[model samples]
Target: MDEIRAKKENKEYDWYVLFVKVGYENKVISQLQSYFNKKMILPFLPKLEIFHKYSNGYIEMEYKILFPGYVFVESNLNEMKFISMIKEFIHYYDAPLKLLKYGDSYEFAMREHEKSMLQSFCNIDFCIEASTGLIKGNKTIVLKGPLKGRESIIKKIDRSRRKAVINIDIMGKCVPITVGLDIPIKLP
Candidate 1:
């Protein structure tokens, strides 16, 4: 059985970020997963864009790199020699070490975190939606918080008491919340 400890030392699967060509994250992930099943995670991402159908008869659209230049890899800390093969398969710009921790669970958590961060980077950094009393009709900027600078469009509201609801879609999950305003809300 796997042990869950309060703390651990050393880890397998270090966090890394690779700058790569757009639309290739999955390709790299696929190649890697084919070699290391259940041992990897390639979170799906959607780049929602407002397309313009020009009167001049051309349709143009913008694409957001939901997960830009990154694909998270999970591996044994003591075994990272073949990680470079991932770089080659993905045609990556480069691979860089992201963080170091003292235990296995922590390290695993960090690896998952890097993956989630990569997948959510653009959306969380650009948009927010608030649907709450008092804060109604107000597009509150994320002045400061865990999601600092990450803005979204208001989808629902309940602002009678200095609160707002923000929405975020992560790894294909929708997370809507009642949050703060002009205050440093403590994060968990």
Candidate 2:
């Protein structure tokens, strides 16, 4: 029981952000997982599920990176050891992998609140599904999905494109992430 509790607490707080070359996020994740066993480290790439429409009226579901070129990781190793391990393993990959640093210093681990906020938006697989909502007067009420109770974080809503932009502060930077939202009903 104690072991399980400790692990859950560790997962909630110990997330590090890595910046990989654009379009090589998956490659880096796979390489890291293979290099170190899955139990040693877990990499997460949050994706947004959206619908793509074709001229023939066929709609297809597609996944796009919620935060491109960035991958979040939870590892059991200490900070220095983890950094050393990643630095050594990075040479094997074709793409570049660097830990996100601030102002000439290495501050890789995310704050607990930041990780918690991200987890709330993403599911177990780190995917943010499309949110269904209704427009009531000037307000948007998310009836179902990850955005349901988090409407206050919405910075802008593009109804036609079915996307909502939310500003999330991660690694001490405010990033605007666009997620899928469908407001099918409008009530006066």
Candidate 3:
């Protein structure tokens, strides 16, 4: 708790918690990391960018981070107090609960990450390849679970949601589905 106004006009706080509007989480996280040593959790997102390889083995890269907003922050009481000094436009997600529950510790960081980290949006073909290396497990590039027959290409990866465009041979139409970074839908 920092006493910005001490003595006669003093105000005290136990901790701090805040939520950045969509697309602003990164801005705040970057600023905080550079300015202070406070611990923080910014749910990382993966963006699909086009990559090309030349015959000479020259490689090119281009992409964007998928998810936006929805960041969970954790830090020490003393360090977090500095958040008050921030003048950016942001709102508190769960101010008291976040402050009381999370702090400067590995457990706090891991817990926050587990709660908001990547979730599988949809399953692709067996050897499905992504521009990023976020995919996990023995599934390799192939998505695990029931969405096996689905061979779709990522049409758009938005901060709010991911759009996968799949061409249905039977229907002869493209279908788009929104999926997170988690395992695709379970087999029906």
Ranking by TM-score: 2, 1, 3
Candidates in order have lDDT scores of 0.41, 0.80, 0.33
* Candidate 3 Cα lDDT to native: 0.33
TM-score of 1: 0.33
Model 2 lDDT at residue 63? 94
Clashing residue pairs found in predicted model 3: 119-180, 119-181, 119-182, 120-180, 120-181, 120-182, 121-179, 121-180
- Of the two candidates 1 and 2, the one with more favorable TM-score, higher being better, is 2
Q: In candidate 2, how many Å is residue 135 off?
A: 0.8
Per-prediction tally of clashes = 21, 0, 8
Q: What is the C-alpha local distance difference test score of candidate 1?
A: 0.41
> Tens digits of per-residue lDDT for model 1 on 18-114?
4445667666555555654343432233333323346775645444443455454444433244344443554543433222232443332334553
- The TM-score measured for candidate 2 stands at 0.87
Q: Estimate each model's TM-score.
A: 0.33, 0.87, 0.29
How many residue pairs of model 3 clash at the backbone?
8
Better candidate number, 2 or 3, judged by lDDT: 2
Model 1: how far is 156 from its true place, Å?
19
| Deviation of model 1 at 44, angstroms | 6.8
lDDT of 2 by residue, 103-179 (tens): 46777778777878888888777888989899999989999999999899999998767789998888888889888
